[model samples]
Structure formats: C-alpha cells, structure tokens
Target: MEFFKTDKIFDFMGKRLPFLGLSSILVIASIIILFTKGLNFGIDFAGGTIVQVKYEQVAPISQIRETLKSTKYANSSITKFGSDEEVVIRITGSSSDLTNDISDEMHKILDSTGKFEIRRVDMVGPKVGGELREKGLMALGLSLIVMLAYVSYRFEWRFAVASILGLAHDVTIALGAIALFNVEVNLDILAAILTLLGYSINDTIIVFDRIRENIQTSKEDELKELINQSVSKTLSRTTLTSLTTLFVVLTLYFFGGEIINGFSFTLLVGIIVGTYSSIFIAATLLVQLKFSIGDFRAKEAEKLKSKREKEKLRAMYEQGTV
Candidate 1:
C-alpha cells in the first residue's frame, strides 16, 4: 500500500534552510542539555540492586515504599513493574552485605504486605558497572566508525560523511531527551541507541542510493532539482517505513512493561529523529557539500556509452550492417 500517491511532489530542498536551522537548534540544545543535566543511569550502569516482587493481590506502591522505609532499602525507589500486583525496587547504594541478602530482605519486608514472590534480583557491583559503562561507550564509538567506513565504501565520501553526521544528530537528540526527562539509561537503552544508529543509517542510505541512481540516469535537472525529485520519488517509501516502525515502537512503549520502557522510549525518539534526518539532515548536507552531478554522472555516462557501443556491435554482427 502506498502512503503517498505516486505523483506527489514535495520541495524538500526548497525548505532546506529552515529544516537545517531547526535541526541545528535542536542538536545544539540537545548538546547543552546533555552537558548540564546528564542521564539517569540505571542499575546496569550504576552499581545497584534491582529487586522485582509480585504479589497475589493489587498492592499500593506507597505501601511498598513505606515498608522499605523501615528497612535498609529505605532509600530505594519503588514503582509498579507491569501491573499493580507487581513492583520493582531499586536501591542505588546497596552495600555488599545488603546486596548479598537483598532477595531475602526484600521477601521478608514485602511478604508482610501479602502473599508475594521474588520474581528476579539483579545486583551490579561498582567495578562491573564501570567496565560495562566503558565498553558501552566503546561500542557506540566503534559503531560510528564502522558506519562511516561502510557508507564511504558504498557511496561517495560526501554522502558517507553526511549520513554519519545525521546518525550522530539522531543519537544526540535521543540522549538529550533522555537526560532532559531524567529517564534512566540502562544497558537496554544503550542497546536501543545502537539499534537506532543502525536504523537511522539504513534510512539515510536508501535516500542516498536513490539520489545516486537519479544522478546516473537523468541529466536534465540541476543538482538541487535532481535531489528534490529523488526525495519526492522516495517519499512514499520513507514515510511508510517510518510510520510502520513507529506504530510498533509505540505499542512496545505502552505495553512492553517498565523493564523495557527505556529501550522502547529511546527507539521512539530515535525513529522520529532518524526519519527527519534521512529526508532533511542527510540530504541537505549533500547540497551543502557542493555535490556535483558531473562527478557522479561521468562514470555512469562512460558505462552507458560502452553498453550502447556493445549493443551496436552485436546488432551489426547479426544484421550484416558492419
């Protein structure tokens, strides 16, 4: 099914300046927010104990908080896990002794409320958390480098640079949103960010590939006009894919439970930013990089010319026209 009609024409390049300006403002603001506020790291990145408890009956979150108030977990955070009958308790600064007996202690403290069961327990030490954090940063950096290399090999260096920058823009804005909203950044969320990087680059490659094809096939339009036509031509595919993915992510965000909340939320933001960058940010960068039609079309022209010459020689051989 088509999200947009085949004949639809949009002047994406016509509004390049406005879109680029808006993207710049957002990226700059995101940078500032990230620097000032910082992300709320979860147990996976910050040393902590996460105890999940499920009760037979609906339990008020406040009662759980009150129950923990008298115990060593008084500073812990209590929130409904997936339903009112379950709750997740996160204690950020659990001592070794406390972490050791956390499951028992949580059972003892929460069992008094009602019939409850310890669903799961996760304990991350400072050293382990530090190592994971370092590795996570390295993974993100390495992914960017790999993406740059791949895009450079697939397309021109200018397109590769633009695509990578667009991916950076999406990631930065996603992180900024996390920081601004004080959402907990966990291993799951970090995974989502990496996934976002892949998806964003994939979308960008689609547009760039289309532009390359257009440059090779048609020589009637100027650079900006060719780009505009290419974007317009591919608008349907881009819109349909992004919207379809958005629908799935929104469902996950709403019903995937609190454990995966950070993951889904990151994807939610990243997809929107990715879609925008694919159309405006990455494509616009091509125009700014002074992309020339001749540079790309010259080789295409030579190949086409050779193909025509071969076809003519075959025709002459068959018809005795040589």
Candidate 2:
C-alpha cells in the first residue's frame, strides 16, 4: 500500500529550524522539571511492599484503593493485573510498625470482602531499590558507551558522536515527556527507557549505514545532498517500521492495562522520536560537524588499497611473480 507518495514533498525539504527549536525548548523544560520536581520514583526505585492478590470474583479496584486510602500507608498504588480478579498493590512505608500493620490491615479488609485471596506478598528494602537505581544508570551509561564505540569502529568517530547525540536527543525527549506528564518512574519505565535507547539506536544505525553506503557510491554529491539522498531512500523503510511498531504499541497502550502502560507509553514515544532523529537529528548532526565525503573516500581508498596490495602479494607469492 503506497501511503501518499512523498516524492512531491521531498522536492521542498522542510525546514528543520522549527523542529530543532521546539525540541530544544522541550528538552530544556523537561530538564528543569526533572531537576526541580524530580521523578516520582515508584516502589522499585524507592523502597516499597508489593502484594499480589487473586480474587475468586471480580472485585472493584476502586474499592480496594479506597480501603488502602483509609489506612495510614503513604504513596500507595493499587492496580489490576491481567484482569479484575487479579490485583497488584504497592505501598511505600518506611516505618516498621506502619508496614507491618498496613499489611495486616489489608489482609483483614480483603478477608472481610470474602472475594479476594492473598496469593503472594513481597517486600523490597530501600537499599535494594537504591542499588537497582544505581545499576540501571550504570547499564544505560554502558549501553551508550558501547554504541559509541561500535559506531565509531564501524564507520567514523563523527558518525559515532552524531549517533550518540541522536540517542541522547531521543532519551531526553522521552524523559522530558514523562516529566511533563508527571508519570511515575518505576522499574518498568526504566526498562522501557533502556529498551527505547537500544531501539532508537538500531533505527539510527540503519540510517547511518545507508549514509555510509551512499557516501561510497554517490560520489557526485556533497555531504548534505548525499545525506538527503540517503534519508530519502530510507524514508519508506523508516516510516513503515515506525508505523508497524506504533500499531502494536497503540494496541498495548489501549488494551494492555496499567501493568504495561508505562512500557507501552515509553515505546510509543520512542518510536516517534527514533524516526525523527534518524531523519533529522542524526543526519543533521553529521552535517553540522562538517563531515565530508572527501575524508571518507580517502579513508576507504586507503583500506581498499591495503586489501588489494595484500591480495596481489598473496597471488605473487603463489605464482612466484613477486
């Protein structure tokens, strides 16, 4: 299905100034919000108790929430799991007495309802949550470093730098959106963010690879034109991939319920941002860095010459022509 051939639109390459300006404002505002208000870390990041309860009959989540609200527990979150019959309750309470009493009270309340059963109860300490947070940060940093090294090794340092910046742009934008919406940052969300980073980079790498190919093959054009051609050639793939993924994510967002909502939301934003970065931000960064095909061709020719020389040397040694 050809979705409105974009050939006509491509004639007038749209100005990126507006996008850059708006994205910059969003990123800056998100950073300010992050520093000022900070993320509302969920039980996984901050210490909390999680209770997974199964009910014989479908019970009202609002009733459960109301029951928990009447208690002295702070920052309680009650959500339905796969169905109304299943519920996951999270509470953040540091006081030993409060934690102990709250659990007991919850059991008593549910027991009175006679429709729910306590299937599992788990408690996470603040220390553990802190460690997880640290580990998560470390993982994100390591992934970025690895991506930078890989891109640099495969292509050029300029590409690596630009790709990483694009990744940062996507991440910052996602985080900013989350902050703007005051969404709770939980382990699921962190995982989503990390997944977004990887997925976004994958999209970027595809574009970068195309650019590299175009640079090698399309020798008549300057860097900007080469990049534009690469982007234009890859536009269909990028759009189709993003749209297909968006369909799945939209499905999850609408039907996956509260459990997967954070993950889905993160993915939705990531896909859009990833597509945008691949087209504009990533290629634009390369252009801004003044990357030239001359340098790339020189490097490539050097590599090709070295390979050919090695091949000739081997052939000469075999045929005694050296």
Candidate 3:
C-alpha cells in the first residue's frame, strides 16, 4: 500500500544540509554519551546468575524481593517472565554456588505459599564474560568488513562507501540510545544489533538500486535533481516496510515479557534510525559524492571495453595453445 501518491516527488537533496547537520549533532552527542556513560552490560557479558522459576500460582515479585533482602541476593532484580506464574531472578555475583543457594533459599521460604519448580539456571564467570565480550566485538567487526566487501563488489565505490557510512550512523545512534537509557546489553541484544545491520543494509541497497536506475535512465546531468527524484520514488516503499516491521517489534516490546525486552528494545531503536539513514544519510551521501549520469555511462563504457579486451586475449591464448 502506498502512503503517498506515486506522482508526488520530495526534495530530499534540498534539505540535505539540515538533515546532515542534525545527524552530525546526534552522532557527536552519541559519541560523547558512549564515552561518559558506557553500556549497561547484562549477565551474558557480565558475571552473574540468572534463575528461572515457575510457580503453581501467581508469583509475588514484591514479596520475593522483600524476602530476599535478608539473604545474599538483596540487590537482585526480579521480573515476571511470560506469565505471572513464571519469574526470572538476576543476581550479579561470581560465586559458583549462587544458583543453588538462590534456589534453596526460595524453596525454603516460598514453598509454603505455592508449589514451584526451578526451571533453569545460568551462571557466567567474569573471565568467561570477558571472552564473550571480545568475541561479540569481533563478530560486529567481521560483519561490517564483509558488508563492505559485498557492497563494493555489487555497486560502485560511491554507493558502497555511502551505504557503509549510513550503517555506521544507524548503529551509532542506536548504541547511543542504549547508553543514554542504560539498557542492558546481552547476547540477545547483540543478535538484535546484527539483525539491525542486515535490516539497514537491505533498505540502503533498495535505495541504491533505484538511484542506479535513475542515473542511467535519465538524460539530465543534474546530480541533486536525479537523487531527489530517486529518493522520492522509493520513499513510500521504505516507509511502508519500516512501518510494517515496527508493528511487530512494538508488539514484542509491549507484550513479549522481560526475557526478550533488551532484544526487542534494540530493534525498536534500530528500525527508526535505519530508516532515516537509508533515506537521508545514505542517499544524501550519493549527492555529496557527486554521482552523475555521465560518470555512470563512463563506467559502463569502461566495463564493456575491458570485456572486449579480455575476450580478444582469450581468443589469442586459445589459438596459441592449439
């Protein structure tokens, strides 16, 4: 479904200065925030114990917290899982017996209230958490390097560079939001960020595809006008796709419970930023890179010339072998 008339055109290039300026401010602010505040690493990246317990009836989170105050898990966090009968407790401790101690203590006190079961327990040592953190960073780096190679091979250098920068912008803003709000960074959230990278590049590729088409099909040499036309053509499609994805993520954020909250929240931030970068940042970068129909034509002509030369060499080489 089209959100706007197909005939309507927007002047994205005309507002490039403002759009770019705003992005610069945001990126700078995000950098500052990241340096000052830092991420709130979860148990997956920070040593801790996580216990999942299921109660026969409603699990009173408040009472559980109050009761645990006198125990070693005084500062523990308690949250309802998928239902009121299920709860997850997260404790920041490096003790090997933490999981068993917590389970035994809960059983000793709350057993009188309702029959419950220990569903699962997770314990990560500080050293293990450090290794995971390093691996996570490596994973992100490898993904970006791979994307850079793919985009460079698929499109022109201009398109490749613009798309990569756009992805960086989207990620930086998303991370900044996480740091600003002190959102928990866990393995699940790392998955969300990786997913966000894929989602973001898909949009950039779509716009880049249109931009390529617009450049070749048009006779005009006005780069800004061509870019504006291309962005306008694809704006409706981009908005529609982002909105549809947002609907699912929003549902997860609101009702998916605490287990996947960080994951869903990361997606929530990434979606909005990704859409903006695809349309404004990535597209505008094309204009800044001074892409033109003449440049595209020259590149195509060069490719054809190179192909003919290769064919001539192959023909000579084959004949010589005989």
Candidate 4:
C-alpha cells in the first residue's frame, strides 16, 4: 500500500553530509571501542565452563565470587541470567576435566545456600573455541567477498562497491554497539551477525535496484535528483518493511528470554542501521560515484548505431554497390 502521493518526494539526499558525518563518527568510535574495550566473548569462543543455577532465593553474585576465589575456580565471571533467582557463572582458563567436575565442586561450594538447582553446564576447550572463532570470522569475510562478486556480476562494480560500503557501515556500527554494551560474543551473536549481513544487504539491494530501474526508465539527467526520486518513491516501502521487522525483533528482544536476547538485539540494531545506510549511505554514494544515466543511454545509442550501420551495409550489398 502506498502511503505517499506521487508528488511527495522526500529529500533524502539533501542532508547526506550530516548523516554521513554522523556515520563516520560512529564508525570511528565503534572501532576505538572494539579495540580498547573489546567484546564480551562467551564460552563458545573464549573456552570456559558455563554454570547456570536457579536458587531457592535471590542469588548473591558477589558472595559467589568471594566463595570461588579460595578455590581453583577463582576469577569466575558471575552475572544474573534472567531473574534474581537465576545466575550464570563462567569459569575460563580451566581444563575440560574441571568442567566435568564442576557439578561436584559447585555443590560443595554453594552448600550453605540451601535448596538450589543446577540448570545447566556447558564446556568448551580452548582449542575448539579458537577454531570456532577463526571459522566464524572466515564466514563473515567470505560472505562479504561473495556479495561483492554477486552484485558486481548482476549490476556493475560501482554498485557492488557502494553496497559493500553500506554493508560495512551497518556491520561496524552494529558490532560497535555490541562491544560498547558488553554483549556476550558467542555462537548466537555470530549467527545474528551473519543474519544481519543478509538482512542489511537485502535493503541495500532494494535501494540500488530502484536506482538502476529509474536510471534506465526515466529521462532524468540529474543523478542526485534521480537518486532522490528513487529513494523517495521507495521510502514508504522501506519504512513499512523496517517497522514490521522492528516489531517482531522488539518482541523477541523483550519476551524471548535471555537465551536469544543478543540475537534479537543484533537484528534490532541491524534493521534500523541497515535501513538508514541503504537510503542515505548507499544512495548518496551513487551520486558521489558519478552515477550517470547517460552511460546507459550511450550503450543504447551504440546498439542503435550498430544496427543502422548493419542495415546500411546490407542495403549496399543488396544494391550491388560494393
């Protein structure tokens, strides 16, 4: 359903500099945050024993840490899972044997806290975690390369480059948000990031596709105006799509429990950031890259010129005029 009248064209590109500047600042800040603070890597990547416990009463995280300090499990990371009664503990720099023996040791340690339940325990070796981390990074890198190849093949190298830039912008900010907020970097978060790549690129492609179609069909000579027009026309669709996605993601974030909180959070940020970059970053980039509809027109002209020349040569041959 179209929410806008045909004449209503939002000047999305008019203020690209401010938005681009904002994006640049955010990207740089995110980079700094990533390097300085780093991510909260979970046991899935950092190699640790995860102990999820549900207490009969409110769990004392500080007391639990104090209790572990005397034991081999010192320096365990303890945090609330979902409620005051639920707690998650991570013990890193320990061997897998410790993970297997955690049940006995934890029970002995927390014996004073009566009537509690061990919800779960997970163990990952350092070597395995490192491999997973390496493979995950490889997957992300390969996805970008594949997308570059695909977009270049389908459209032009310029479009591929522009879309990749937009995607990079989305990813950088999303990861930065994750790091800044100290979100757990695990297989789930990695999955969410990969999902984000697809979600973001889909939006970028939509904007780029409209620009391509408009360039081919419209007689508009001004690239900026064409881009503005294209984005304006697709604005409603983009808004609706992003809103619907936000609703679902927001729901998952709020009510899906802590298990998928990081996943939904990534999507939530990705959808908004992706939408913005597609409309502003990607579209504005086309203008900066000197996207010209005249190129297509030139190609068409060349084809017509070649056809006319062929016709003239055929006529001369038919007339036996050499």
Number of backbone collisions per candidate = 0, 0, 0, 0
Between 1 and 3, whose lDDT is larger? 3
Per-residue lDDT tens digits of candidate 3, residues 102-207?
6676678666556789888888888889899999999999999999999889888888889889989999999999999988899998999999999999999998
lDDT of 1 by residue, 131-173 (tens): 8999999999999999999988877899888988898899989
State the lDDT of candidate 2 residue by residue for 1-322, as single tens digits: 5454545234212555666676678678878888887787776778777787888888677777766665664357877777768988877854353545555667886665557777777676788889989998999999999999999999999999999998888998888778777677888898899889888888889988988997888755677667667777778888888899999999999998767887898888888988888887887888778888898899999999999999999999999987
In model 2, where is the ten-residue run with the lowest total lDDT? Answer: 4-13
lDDT of 1 at 129: 88
Clashing pairs in 3: none
Instruction: Report RMSD (Å) for each prediction in the order shown.
Output: 4.4, 3.4, 3.0, 3.9
Better of 1 and 3 by TM-score: 1
Off by over 4 Å in 1: 94-99, 111-114, 298-322
Give residue 321's error in model 2 in angstroms.
Answer: 5.2
Kindly provide the TM-score of model 1 when superposed on the true structure, using C-alpha atoms: 0.87
CA lDDT, every model vs. true structure: 0.87, 0.80, 0.87, 0.87
Q: Once model 3 is optimally superposed onto the true structure by TM-score, how far is the C-alpha of residue 277 displaced, in angstroms?
A: 1.1
Task: Show the colliding residue pairs in model 2.
Answer: none
Number of backbone clashes in candidate 4: 0
Model 2 error, position 149 (Å): 0.4
